[model samples]
Target: MDMYIRVKRSKSTYFIRCKPSDKIIGIKQKLEEIIDQPVSDQRFVLPGTGEILEHIKTLADQKVDSDAVVALTLRKDVNEFEEVNIVGPNDFYQSRDADDANW
Candidate 1:
């Protein structure tokens, strides 16, 4: 089945459409297109378990399902990957539920 992952980095979020059989490298490639960072400079992690996603593995192999939250980290000048830094949505957007309250 097709799946979409939410890739987060700092204050930006990328909704990537993918398949279970798609490799982690494919995801990196997608990110590279939008972030202007090479695949070699990109890193992905599961925020919940802090597990690093391997480029050679498929999404199914990593148990990354639809709507999964994957954190993106990029290599810095020192050649070290930065820490996961995802920013939550602003309070105004979370003020009320869409179905229960008016915008």
Candidate 2:
């Protein structure tokens, strides 16, 4: 029988279905496919306790049942920031010059 579980990441939740005998790594792979992120960058944890889900254990070993919820977080090594353009004080004043000229 296939077991179903809900994985919550940030504000999004994903429902995954698999066999109880399936390894945790398999689930992580499925999550990678869904989220378009590598398994190495993913961290699965139990809700509330912050306990990490073991990669070597199966769904059965974890006692995961249908509709159970697991929390997903990015690994520390994964970059969380995106490239952004910073506006320095000089740049801000330069851009404001045009508007200031009209005043």
Report how far residue 94 has shifted in candidate 1, in Å: 11
For each candidate in turn, the TM-score is 0.84, 0.70
Residue-pair clashes per candidate: 0, 0
Error of 2 at 17 (Å): 0.9
Clashing pairs in 1: none
- Model 1: lDDT equals 0.92
Candidate 1, residues 51-89, lDDT tens digits: the string is 999999999999999999999999886669999998887
lDDT by residue (tens digit), candidate 2, 1-103: 9878988765577889899998889999998988998887777777756667789998889887778888877755556622222233464355646667653
Between which residue pairs do clashes occur in model 2? Answer: none
lDDT of 2 at 98: 62
Error of 1 at 67 (Å): 0.3
Q: lDDT per prediction?
A: 0.92, 0.75
lDDT value, candidate 2, whole model = 0.75
